[model samples]
Target: MNGLKAGLAELEALIAAPVLGGCNLLVCPPATLAAAFAARAAGTHVQVGGQDCHWQPSGAHTGDIAAEMFADLGASHIIVGHSERRTDHGETDAIVKAKAEAVARAGLTPILCIGETLAEREAGEALVLIERQLAGSVPEGLAALVIAYEPVWAIGTGLTPTVAQVAEVHAAIRAVVGPGVKILYGGSVKPSNAAELLAVPHVDGALVGGASLKAADFLGIAAGAA
Candidate 1:
């Protein structure tokens, strides 16, 4: 709840900033803040989204928000299978696949996240991990989905893979996802590294985190993407 409020406040400020006037920005806050942020983002370039959603539209789930609810609140996008959800909530690829289908059913785009942990990377199984995740997490029809490659070890660790490494993984993802889908890179992406990361082949944009919490940083990253 606190994070959602803080992120919405930050997004409000960023949208108001003159420097970020021309950038394409999307902020996926918690579902509770989706409506508020969408209202606040009106007349601005910033687009509001949801951090996650339940596959079922309306059901017996006690604490789950549905993608249709987010859509009703004006969310155009929703993220699924973020590393935090995968690790902290024990969400598997099959679950994420369901969520992605729900997002599509609700008429929203799903930004599906896929990545490998440090141990997996060290074992030289990063690509294998990504392939498995992709195969299981993504559905056959992917036109309504976006893929984000966020190395779990790099997220919030102030560490990132090299440009060559980023390019390699992104290319492999593209090959699997085919030419229609857009692939994004996420993992401690900031203005400092945004340009280089965006320059990598198949990297369409970013699913920023820490840097996204700040207006200057987020705008800088957006500019880098441009």
Candidate 2:
């Protein structure tokens, strides 16, 4: 919903700059800009991705983009089960799993999102619920994948969990997904707290939101990954 061709030019230069900390960067722009951005990002460290995709390769599901379409657009990865989609579209873990499977079939990686709502966290069911979602949403035998832990309550709220809180959930996720999977911490992640949050055990990377819209902020966060 943000960024146009004009904005892409700025992003192109920033993303290509040397100060990006050598971290893996992926941009998931609106569908209209995916092809354009992917073309610009070629041969650079920045990879392009999609916000969402349908599980079925082709169907009458109008207004829904399929995994194959994302691959066709040169997207190396697609996000599934984001809290926004789960809450706004009523997507369940079963649906997320199917979408992940479709992404695998399309020869693209899937970044699966799993997190708890504020009420769930308050009720002390965060780990229990996240584990349930993991079991139901993650597909078996994916060559490459990423999992993002974004507490629904923290997203866009400018409120973040304590580092220990993030570590607790990440550790639980590690136990379930095993050692090889990469777990990301999302939810209001800004440069100020990026270093501390990234230092937490099992926190592989970030699933940045608003901060990613600005190259300086995004790079600052990447720099904190060290």
Quote each prediction's TM-score: 0.94, 0.97
Task: Count clashes in each candidate, considering only residues at least 3 apart in sequence or on different chains.
Answer: 0, 0
lDDT tens digits, residue span 122-196, model 1: 999999999999999998866778999999999999999999899999999998988889899999899988988
Give one digit per residue, the lDDT tens place, for model 2 in 1-226.
Answer: 7888786975676666784554788888888899898888887788999999999999999999999998987889999999999999999999999999999999999999999999999999999999999999999887688999999999999999998899999999999899998999999999999999999999999999999988888888888995
Q: List runs of model 2 lying over 4 Å from the truth.
A: 19-22
Q: Local distance difference test, per candidate?
A: 0.89, 0.91
List candidate 1 segments past 4 Å from native: 1-9, 18-23
Q: Candidate 2: minimum summed lDDT over ten consecutive residues — where?
A: 13-22
Q: How much is the lDDT of residue 223 in candidate 2?
A: 87
